[model samples]
Structures are given as structure tokens and as C-alpha cells.
Target chain A: MLAKRIIPCLDIKDGRTVKGINFVDLKDAGDPVELAKAYAERGADELVFLDITATHEKRKTLLELVEKVAKVLTIPFTVGGGINSCEDVAQILKAGADKIAINSSAVRCPELITELANRFGSQCVVLAVDACETQEGWEVYLNGGRIPTGIKLFDWLKEAERRGAGEILFTSMNHDGTKNGFANEALAEISEMLNIPLIASGGAGNMHHFADVFTKGKADAALAASVFHYKEIEIPELKNYLKSEDIPVRL
Target chain B: MEKQNIVIIDYEAGNVQSVKYALERLGVNAEISNCEKTIRQADKVIFPGVGEAAWAMKKLKETGLDQLIPQLKQPVLGICLGMQLMCAHSEEGNTKGLGLFPVNTLKFPAEDKVPHMGWNQIRQLKGKLFEGIETESYAYFVHSYYVPLNEYATAETHYIKSFSASLQKDNFYACQFHPEKSGDIGQAILNNFIKL
Candidate 1:
């Protein structure tokens, strides 16, 4: 049986982790490498570093950080944010990232997905879709869920899969940060539609939210940020809870 | 034991850096090279691959590794696509493999998710590759195709069905999972391989 994964997503800015991470023992909370090592030690199945840095010059810092993180961490990690081309992905993978997630760049040119899948293999390509519920339907969003693309979520997801996206990381803007729950209805539909793995993101407040995402949403993995960063939910404890609920997790 | 000369074959198949880093953590430095002479000289060779079968086979053939690999006398371990390529054939890309394992790689039936991603257990363990590792230990796996149960399989994992998680035949060993990324249990397996 393939175990459901628990991932901790960290926002990176100028090679440093943004958004307060409340680990008391952490020597440097802003250090992405240290935070990543901590999360992995606590039973995080994987880690995602979303580089939020704006400047092109700062991109080099992210690559250095990725190399440092890859050297120390044993688990799989994905590097995303501002990855635009095959060259960018090559550098990241060369820097030792296990996978690379592309969002807006993929929307701008869908061929990038096929090219990446062909060159680097589909296993390392992750298509992250930011979506929001609207009067029309679950419309895909861009630029960190600020701009709407008018494309329906299901339609875009179908295209992404067809374009050779190995996995889908779907984050619902409406439910994100609400601490309410996941968009299970939409997630279940997407999971049913695609053959690849689906990673449910956003609206993860409690451990039950994790359970709901896996059981109700049928997500192969669940990713959360603040809840994990602030110690609102500990990974080992959460895995124990999931195990009790009959959800398969690596202990 | 004197320092073992380890070489990880690099043919632009996929991420070989992760494998190097994993070995580094074990205090063993492994040279990453595609050169036939370097691979032929190493005491142990690690063939790490990730990607399409036919395409990888093309790359291997271009480097003349397709001939050198099957003849190596030292212990040679293959990972993921490396493991699949050790088999006789693959349904992916209709690829003919190295024919070392006498098995065939086939795509997972569409009854479940295509790629068997995330952590899964390897059971019915046999051979020194899994020494000191418990049976049913979890290892990280990410692939759409799998090698069905066969005589060469030293370990088995059940996804859509029981498939070869690890295979061993004489000096050749292979694993369908990414032991480099499988945390403690995976590290232990790598340690066992290094000792072998």
C-alpha cells in the first residue's frame, strides 16, 4: 500500500524562509535548510520550498539554498516559484531538488510541460494550479491566486495531465488560510479525473482536515504551511492520528 | 575494509545528485561518471536512473554503457528506471532492456493511480541488500511502470498487485524505489549495499 504523504510547505524569500515558523529549538527559524531538516526529522514525508523572491539576482540564492538543503535532507523535496523554462528546471534539479513545480509558466506555454516531461521525465514535473470558486466555476488563478485565467479548473487540469504533468498540486484560494477544511468536493472530482497523483493544498487547520483531504478528498498527499510551522499540528502526532483513522502513513 | 571505490553511472537519465548526497551522508564519497573506464574500475557501481525507458536506453547506447554494464564483475546496483532497464524488456516505449534479470517491466493497470508515488513497504525480503532491515519496511517509490513478481525479485511490494521491489541475480542488484529518498530505512538499505 502506498502511504498518504504529509508535506510542509515553506515560503522562501531571498534565500530565507518567510512567514514566522515557531520552532523553539530551531537556531535560525528563517533558514530554509534548518527548517527543512527539522521537518524531515519530525516525520514529514516531503518538503516544498516556494521561492517567493522577486528579483532575478536573488534566484541564485534559492539554488544555493536548494543545494544546501539537498545535502542535509534525506527525504524528497520540490522547488517552485518563478521557474520559467527547461533551463531553470535543469539548474534546480542539478542543484539536487527531487521535483520542480511550475504554475504560471505552464499556463503561459503548455508546451513547457511536455518538453519538461520529455527531457527530465514526468516523475519530476509537478503542475501546481491555484483555483478559486466563482460564478462561472472553479476558475484557475495566476500570479499567486490574484489574477483569474477564465479557464475552468477541470478543463485546465485535464489539459495539464494530457501535457504530461506527473502530479497535480491543487490549491483552492477560497478555502486557503480559512482553517475551515479542504475543498473536498472539487478535489474528489479532480482525483477521479486524473491518473496521476493529486496533492491537496490550502484550508488545512486541524488533523481532521488532513484526514478529510485523504479520505473524502482522495488526495494522495496533503500539504500545509502555518499549521505545521506554528506547531498547531505536529507531524508525528498527526501521522499517529491518521494511522488510528485507518489512513496508511509512514511511521 | 579499505575504502571501496564506488562509481554512480551518469548518462543524463535523471537526478544522480541525490544518490551521491545519500552516499556522502554515509561517509562514502561516490564518483559520478559516464565514462566506461571509470565505471569499470570501481569496486562497486551504482546505476541510478529516472525517466522514459526507450529514451534512457538510447542515452545508454550512445554512451556505449549498454555493453559495459552487463559485463561488470563487481557488484552493480540499479535504481528505479535503472532496475527496469536491467530486465529483458519494458512496455514503456517498447524498450528492449539489458536482459540481466530475465523479467519485463509493464505499466500498472488503470485500476488505481498510474504512478505509485509515496511510501510503500517491501516484503518477502531476501539477500544481503536488505540485511538488518525489517521485512515490510517502507520505502519511497514514484513510477508508472513496475516489474511483475519474478524469480529475480528479492523483495516484493504490493500496489495494484505484488511487484518486484528489489531484484538480485548473482552480482546484479536493483530496486524500483528511491532508497536515496526513503529516509532511515532507505539509508540502512544503502548502507547494506555499500557493505556488500
Candidate 2:
């Protein structure tokens, strides 16, 4: 059986690593490449470098950053943010990114997912969904979770999958900065609804939350920023905890 | 002393740089090459790729490598999609491959995740590729379609189901994972291949 992954997400802004609470009040972590090497050495299964500023930049700079990270990091690295076209996908993949995550672009043009998947294979393309729980129930939001589409999370997830997204990185906007725990109910719904792997992001307080996401939420992996950036939960320690819990994690 | 000339075939696919870097890190004399004479003259060849199987195969066909690969005399190594393309046929694009190995690749069952992405354990080990690695040690994987286990299978992995993790047939050796990204175990596997 394939083992579940433990990933640390690093948000890059102007080539520097940054972490925020609920995607605001950004705090400087360190150089993106340096932090990536540290996480890989400390036993991170994979590292995700999100160029949060890519959407705002005049020209795409994530490719340059990916080239830098690829130089030092040996483990698989995924790059996301501001990927708009098939050429962007080709450029990043050529720069040694193991995978590329498409968020806003995917929502804006659903065909981009199929175009990428058809051209590069589905495994290279990932759909990043920022979802929030509302009175009408969980809904999908786009453009860094700033714009609410009012589309039901379940419907959007299914649509993304149908469009050839290999995996879905579901981030809960409600619990993003709270670090209380994952939106277990929402994750469970999606996990049960779709057969594809679900990467639970947003709120992860401690190692226990990681365990909960896997056991209770049925997430294939737990992607966190603040928890790992602040050193609140060491990757090796978390893996050990998950091992004791009978979850198959690569040592 | 004859230096082992290893050339990684390049056609703008993913994972080539890491493979080149890994070979360089191992102090192995390797380069990325697209020239026919260079590939034909190399002592050993490493074909590493991570992208659409159909498109990559098409690129190979366009370069006339699709024909050149099958007749090569030296030992050849293919990683990930490279391995899948060695099979007789691949369901990835209904692609007809190099036919180096008498096997067919198929997509993962729809009941499970389309892409069997993540690290999985290797079992039913065979050949020198797994020299020091113990049974069930993990290797990184990122593919949806897999070449089914057959007589050429060197190692097998179980994701949604048991599939070929590595395959070896005469001078051709292939793996479904990226050794350049698999850490120690992966390096060990690559080292064994280099020694081959």
C-alpha cells in the first residue's frame, strides 16, 4: 500500500519565505530554498512552495524560485500560484518541479485543467481549492479565497476531478489561521465523496491534528504552514506519532 | 581507464535536471544529450522523464529516437514514464512504445485515485537494482498508469493494487519511481544501476 505523505507548505513572497495567520499578517520565515532544505533534511515527505505574490507580480517569478529550490532540495518539490497557461506548466515542470498546483487559473478557466492534464498528464496537475464553511454549507472560493463563488464544495470538487485534476489540495478558510484543528466534517465529506487523494490544509495545531486528519478526516496527507514554520510540530516526531497510531508513514 | 559515458535523453520532459544532478552528485560522468552519435557512443544510457506518456513518446518518435532506442547495444535505464514507454504498449495515450519489454501498461482502476501519487513499498525484488535495500523500503512514485507485472518485472509495488515497481530485461532496466528524489534508498538503487 502507498504510505500517506507529510508535507510542509512554504509561501514565498519576493523570493523570501513567509507564513501568515488565515493568509494575512505575513511573518518572515527565511529564504525559500534554505527552508526547503531544512524541511527535507528534517524528514518532510515533500515540500510545497507557493508563490503567493505570483498573482500580483508583473511577470511570473515562481519559475526562477523553483529553479533555485530544485538546486538544493533532493526530495520531490511542488510549485504553485499564478500558473495561467500550458506554457507556464511546461516551464515550471522543465525547471524540475515534480508537480504543479493550479488554483485561481483552474477556477477561472476549467479547461486549463484538461489542457494541462492532456498535455502533461494528470499527475503533474493538482487542483487547489480554498473552501469555507457557510450557512448554506461549505462553498468553494477562488482568487486566494477572497472571492466566493458560492459553488458548493462537493460539486466543485467533482467538477475538478471530472476535468482531469489528479489530486485536490483542499484548504479550509474558516480554520486556516485558527489552528484549532482541521475542518474534519468538511474534509470527511469530500474524502468520502471522491475516490482521489485529498490533501487537508489550513488548520493544523499539533501532531494530534495530523493524526485526526488521517484517521477521522480520511485525508491522504496533511499540509500545514504555521505548525511547521513555527516549529510547533517536528516532522519526525509527527511521523513517529502517526506510526504508533498504525498509520503507514515513510520514515 | 574507460570512463562510463552516461547520457540522459532530453526532450524537455520533467525530472531530467534532477537525474543529471543525482548522477553528478554520485561522481558519475553523465550529460544530457539529444545527439544521435553521442547516444550511440555512450557506455550506458539513462532515459528519465516525468510528463505525459503519449506526448513524450511522440517527441521521441519525432526525433527518430523511437527507432534508435530499440537497436542500442549498451545497457539502458528508463525512469518513471521512461519505464512505461519501454513496454509494448501503454494505455496512457494508447501509445505504442519502444517494445523493449514484452508488457503492456494500464491506467489505475477508476475505483481508486487516478494517479497513484506518493511513495510505496517494493516487493518481489529481482536483479542488482535492489542490492542493499531491504524488502518493502519506500520509493517515490507519481504516475497514474503502470506497467503490469510480468516476467520482466524486477520489483513490484502495491498501491491500489500490486504493479511493477521496476522491470529488467536484458540490457534494458526501468523503474516506475524517481531514484533522484527517493533519498538513500533511491540512491542505492541508482548506484546499483550505475554499477551495472
For all candidates, the clash counts are: 0, 0
Clashing pairs in 1: none
Which candidate has the highest lDDT of all? 1
The regions of model 2 sitting more than 4 angstroms off are: A55-61, B1-3
What are the per-residue Cα lDDT tens digits for candidate 2 across B1-196?
2467899998766678889777766778688988899999988899888777788988898898988888888889999999999999998779988899988999888777657878888888888888888998889998878887788898999877788999998899999988899877887888888888
Error (Å) of candidate 1 at residue B20 is 0.4
Worst 10 residues of 2 chain A by lDDT: A55-64
Candidate number with greatest DockQ: 1
lDDT per residue as tens, model 1, A64-115: 9999999999999999999899999999999999999999999999999999
After aligning candidate 2 to the native by TM-score, how far in Å is the CA of A238 from where it should be?
0.5
Residue-wise C-alpha lDDT for candidate 1, range B6-43, written one tens digit per residue: 99999998879999999999999999999989999999
Candidate 1 chain A lDDT trough over 10 residues, lowest sum: A20-29
- Considering just the first chain, candidate 1 attains a TM-score of 0.96
